[model samples]
Target: MAKAFASQGDLTEKEISFTEIGEGLYAFTAEGDPNSGVIIGDDSVMIVEAQATPRLARKVIDCVRSVTDKPISHVVLTHYHAVRVLGASAFGASQVVMSEKARSMVVERGQEDWDSEFDRFPRLFQGHEEIPGLTWPTTTFEGRMSIYLGNRRVDLMQPGRAHTAGDIVVYVPDQNVMFTGDIVEYHSACYCGDGHFHDWPRTLEAIRRFDLDAIAPGRGDALVGRDMVNAALDLTGDFIRSTYRPAARVALRGGSLKDAWDAVRAECDPKFSDYAIYEHCLPFNVARAYDEARDIDTPRIWTAQRDKDMWEALQG
Candidate 1:
């Protein structure tokens, strides 16, 4: 290979922040690393997203302990991404829940994704040895489901296909706050390797229609007000559009993958170069955008070998 993946060189640890976005609702963010959300109810707690490893999940546990001693009754996964679901065992929650489609994805490509992501981002998997195996959900829902932690209604819904076909958002209606997975990122780059480029903007609009007061985004900081929530939504939509437009144009015109890459860069680099993981996500985003534009509805599974081949073809 000519050079390593961008995430391979990102070994520096980011500063962690546990910010309260709403009453009993917190966002555990590590700069541009994967973020998690916490919701405390009358008797128990619910976790929105788990980190990549048990060692990483402990940080979220520590933060949860700081504010409340209630037991974690449920762990709600936003999607089937390895970085977000592999750390579930550490929570020791009685109920681990996911969308039915997401569970199917876990059965299909979970192991491949875990291997792919582990190789692509080594620093995120600090405790790979502790992982028993692939994580599975104890409960699965079709489209939407609501759980009550002692009268606190928590709604989990899949607005539409965006980051993935099964992506869901965790909404606490009482607080008017939502925990959007990779569907909505704050200042970080959206990893579109498993995305629906054409359906993403409509998903963004679906989220925006709620007029949320606050949101704990997939990456970056906690949005604590309507203004910040809207800003994140708008910025995330812009990121998706900026990445897909040029690549789609290139692909429809019968351009090569390298040609699509350059076209995407010319359009995205000026606006998104400084975004976290921008360089790391660009190639895969371009390739996926190109594929989707060429009428590939479902994203190809990203195995470790596929990751290498793609990186070598684009980055080598």
Candidate 2:
């Protein structure tokens, strides 16, 4: 028997948890599901990573209402993935913030990404109809910017590129808590379909410079305390390096794509087999790694049709 197409086989709903890592920082995570971070300042709130649709976003809003009454003033997008950005409308945030690179990526491939992601994981797109099309950023910065919500400071920085060409991290310097969106996944498998393999570790090194007491990664439970934070960062780095090393070696040797795919699975599965979305992400991750190893700087745009084709070739 063959495996089901990407995430199509995943039907189980994950249990959600809202953990307070700091006085005003919360991590909204669903057992390995895509996570969201909530940052509450003295007067306003900022959401890091919107859910897939407005209907799905309401659940986060409910979570937000449970804690703070401060109006959501901003929605910060770490990167331009449909699952993370399409739910912006539900927050009614006055400003949607992102990096200039992220905005450009959205303008270039947001629609195709929307269709590609929806088809790959329909369960996450439960409120597909409620999406008001592509989520656009109201404010964009070139490198890094500090946002003050009534005196409390939050720094948003583009620490090079990892998961995507325009990945960003939300750092609260005083709280020592960072919301690392997709740049560092916890137990969840790192989705590298749109990633840059070589630059990823350099970006991770950039993130490590922060004096973080806690971290809320793109997926999985939030890590609190320095030891746990370091462990999570190490795990994310290990996953990325393990997946890319073997695949890249095969690609550099002029091996077939199948060889690269096999190399990644052989190298990565032994360690990451229990990680969430490992199976679903392997083929796409290997494909991207292969391209990167072959000197392809830019990631290919993923469309619904391209998704099916790649799955059929590598995972079918």
Candidate 3:
């Protein structure tokens, strides 16, 4: 019998946690589901990584309303993933920001990604019809952009490509808190369907240079305190290496994609099988790793058709 398609079978709603990890900083995490980071300034609020849809994002908005009356003035897109950006309209932010590379990705494949992801994870896109359309950024920066909310400073930087070609991190120097999108997940599978495996470690290294007191990752729980933050970062780096290395080795040896998948499972299952979305991500992650290992520089676009074919080929 064929396995359930992607996350189509995952319909259970997770318990949400809205926690303040630092001064006026909040993380909206749902028990291993996608997360969003909230940064409250003196006058306004800045949200990092919008939820999957406007209806789903409203829950996050409700959480924000519970804390402050400040209007959301900035919506930051860490990358151009549907689960992260399609909810931009819910924020009503004056400025929607993302890296130039990320913006380009949205222009190139935003619609395809939207369609592909909705089919892959129906549960995440519960209010799919409510999504106005493709999410476009009002501002696009190259390397770094500094945003000042009254006196509080928030720095947005694209360290390097990891989760996507334009993955960005939100850093608050004053609080020493960072919001790393899918670049570094905590106890959650890093979706590598559009990742840069060879460059992910380098990107992770760049993030390590910061003295982080806390980190709000793309998924899983928020990490507070320096020790826990460091551990989370280290674990994320380890996960990236472990997932890609074996598949990469197999690919380099001219093995079949199945061989690469088998290699990855042998190496990762023992340690990461219990992680959220581990099973859902393995096929896609292995496919990307195999491509990167064989020196495929740019990640191939994942259309709905491609997602189905890849799943059946590997997990069927």
Candidate 4:
């Protein structure tokens, strides 16, 4: 490859912030790295989105320890991305939960996603030796499931396919706060390599209808009010549309992948260049958007070699 992916050069450590969004709801964010959500129930706690490795997961555990001594009994994965689910062992939760489709993806492409992610961003996988193996959900649900942390109710529902075919959001009705996984991002580039560009907006509407008071987004700071929450949603929607529109146009015109990349950059760079992981995500986003525009519904799995091939080709 002529050069490494932008994330390959992102070795600098990010400062972690644990912010409370509601009475017992918190968001654990690390700059633009994947964010984790903490929900304190009447008895135990529920975690959303485990980090990449056990070592990274410990950072979230540490934050939990600082706030409450309640044991983490449930770990709800929002999707099947390796960065979000491979650290379940660290939580030692009694139940690790995921949507049925997500569990299937883990079985189908879990290893490939892990390898491709390691190639792209090594910092997130600091404790590669401690990963044990692919993380699997002990509990799986079809569309929706409600788990009670004593009196507190946590609803895990698959709103629609957006970030992935099995993306789910953890909603706390009592607090009016939702832990949206990669379905929503703030100021950070959405990794569309395994995303549904067309369905994402509709899924966002499903979430917006909840009129959440706050949101713990996938990769940015905790949104604590309606204005901030709306801003994050708007930014996420704009980013997706800007990237896909130009790429779709290129694909419709029967242009090359490189041409699609160029068109997407011309449209997105001006608005999203400063967002975290922007450069790293652009090529993959364009590739998927072009594929979707070409009428491919299911996203093709990404492998380490495929990552390099796509990166190298776009370097032209």
TM-score of each: 0.99, 0.99, 0.99, 0.98
lDDT string for model 2 (59-172, tens) is 899999999899999999999999999999999999999999999999999999999999888899986988888999999998899999998999999889899999999999
lDDT of each: 0.93, 0.92, 0.92, 0.93
lDDT of 2: 0.92
Alpha-carbon shift of residue 195 in model 3 (angstroms): 0.8
Candidate 1 vs 2: which has more lDDT: 1
The digit string of per-residue lDDT tens for model 4 on 153-196 reads: 99999999998999999999999999999999999999999999
Where in model 2 is the C-alpha error above 4 Å?
none
Cα deviation of 182 in candidate 3 (Å)? 0.5
Per residue, candidate 1 scores C-alpha lDDT tens digits across 243-306 of 9999989999999999999999999999989999998998899999999999999999999998
* Residue 89 Cα positional deviation in candidate 2, in Å, after optimal superposition: 0.3
Candidate 4 TM-score to native: 0.98
RMSD of 2: 0.8
Off by over 4 Å in 3: none
